[model samples]
Target: MSARLAPVDMTAFSPGRCARLIVKVGSALLVDPDGQVRRDWLKGLVADIAGRVRAGQQVAVVSSGAIALGARRLKLPKGGRASLEDAQAAAATGQIALSGVWAELLHGEGLTAAQILVTLDDLEDRRRYLNVSATLDRLLKLGVLPVINENDSVATEEIRFGDNDRLAARVASAAGADGVILLSDVDGLYDRNPTTHPDAVMIPVVEKLDARIESMADRGSASGMGSGGMVSKIEAARIATSAGAHLAIATGRIDHPLQALATTGHGTIFVASQGARARKAWLRGGLTAKGTIHIDAGAVEALRQGRSLLSAGATRVEGRFARGDLVVIAGPDGTQLARGLAEYDHVDAHRITGRRSEDLGTILGYAPRSALVHRSHMALL
Candidate 1:
């Protein structure tokens, strides 16, 4: 008997299903061998972006090329390993030129493009992460395309995200994007190195990244101009999928890459492990509890029944925690029940403990949220 084939779902790759999409363009796609920007390719990409925007889907671009562009402009040595300072200096020079080109191209498409430079620290720090998320949200709401890039000029080896692939995944997670597309030189992931093995087969869809799948990843970038390789892209897929975002790796050498990927199913699509709500729950479960709230038995039962924790049921509050901080909800016997974002600060929580929702205004002199811990922000243990 002949080998059996798996069924393919073309509709799963459609970009229309995604409310927010993040596209990562590698340096090779943006720059040529001679260190010049590929205008025609960029124009095609902009057109695709415009189409997505017209369709009411928010799109963000995480691009790489500043160092390459900067090195060319500075007349730095080519085909040789450059020092960190040299790379940083080139990035500083290239970023301005790159931003200008993006602005002009996006403007021609009747879309405003805003440049956003971020380092790993921005996403790793909770306070800074929230700020970055807020900024990106506001930009999208204001109908602007965010062109995000790593702050290579200021980032050192220790602090650098190192490649745009991982940065794009972080951006997708922070922006709550439903899909992430990595445009590369190759079409998609292969069972083996396609360049080296003539019999290597392409993987159409990856439901999960297992150890066997990881072992097949090649180490170096196919395009010399880019830093990320198959290994990095696989890592990115892990991050994106775990955060409930579908990830696709596709070739950008063609015109209108995003459109091609969506309509033709010309890539390897990694299905998200969970949906948006599950992603939020994952985040809630991952946070460190800054304080604890001891609730009554009724409240514990209510939580288990999918109800919010009200002030009336919170019998005691422990530790000093501010609003928005993650706190553990405990049963009267001190067993942890759930974790959630605190609506009230420790001072206010203490004052309103065991009080009814209607009496919150009188107790605290100002009522904000009705539930002490909103169900939407809480995750049961």
Candidate 2:
């Protein structure tokens, strides 16, 4: 399917008003040669964020570097190339140490920091996504700063996010963040590899990204310490921007990286498209459909015209899904029109087949209230 599109302009927004922020810091900036959490760095970061809090801004910290530091701590034999499993083990070790460091630093700054380990599934499932979003919102309101990391220790390859850069973007979208600054070792994205070509220019504003722009992109440096390269950052930008959040890729080695990007715009900024509600964003990013619901011509028109699904129009339920499960709604010709939580079980749906909403009660011994799947529970597919 073609990607969903939105329209946003980063230049139109000033740095201050962007209250909800997602700040991503990479592993290269967080670990020392000995594989320890850089205490001084963590302290500085907490202090910087504390200033923002005092200014009445809400921030979410998306941090990487756990695996690298963990590997160092464990003194794992330095293999030429570490497998994904090896990285996962290292992350498991490092995640605990990383959280401790953040907690200590934030405590010193008179603030509370909470660890939120997540996997790709957390962002992909509607119920889980809403649960997480609500938790983050409540934490922010209660004067807590959330430090999110990939659930590397437990996540299998299939459910993993792979890199925190993309995770940051998703988190930003989940929180409706004003801006997402990806802090990495390099200064920002350049037209070409700057190390090989000294004249490679750092393009400042990415008004739009297309095939031409993607052609200039490259995979990250082959160093094992960092998880994301430039292309991953670009990909994250695409996700965040599409979700209606501003995004920036900037140098993390700089002191006060988050503050600098917020005030000075010292990074490559990608504009955003349209902002979606938490439910819509979750539907777009997370929920996977179990089966299809074939509808009549009238049903298709009603759905496309932004109408809800009633019992009468649902000609068939193609899958065995429990009530409250996500299912696809299809037109008679077989194109998906919407996705929503099924209100009735497959058997019940069959029992009430071809009946109107008002008829459901008489047909099934209970009166129905709203559409089979309410519009609030449905998102256009």
Best by TM-score: 1
Tens-place lDDT per residue, model 2, 152-191, is 8778889988889999998986675778888787766678
**How many collisions between residues are there in candidate 1?**
0
Per-model TM-score, in order, reads 0.81, 0.71
Model 1: CA > 4 A from native: 1-8, 78-81, 284-287, 292-318, 322-324, 328-338, 341-381
lDDT of candidate 1 over 46-136, digit per residue (tens):
9999999999999999989998889888877642127778778888998999999999999999999999999999988755665677678
How high is the lDDT of residue 25 in model 1? 93
- Model 2 worst lDDT window (10 residues): 1-10
Which residue segments of model 2 deviate by more than 4 Å?
1-15, 77-81, 275-381
- As a TM-score, model 1 comes out at 0.81
| TM-score of decoy 2 | 0.71
Each prediction's whole-model lDDT (CA): 0.85, 0.75
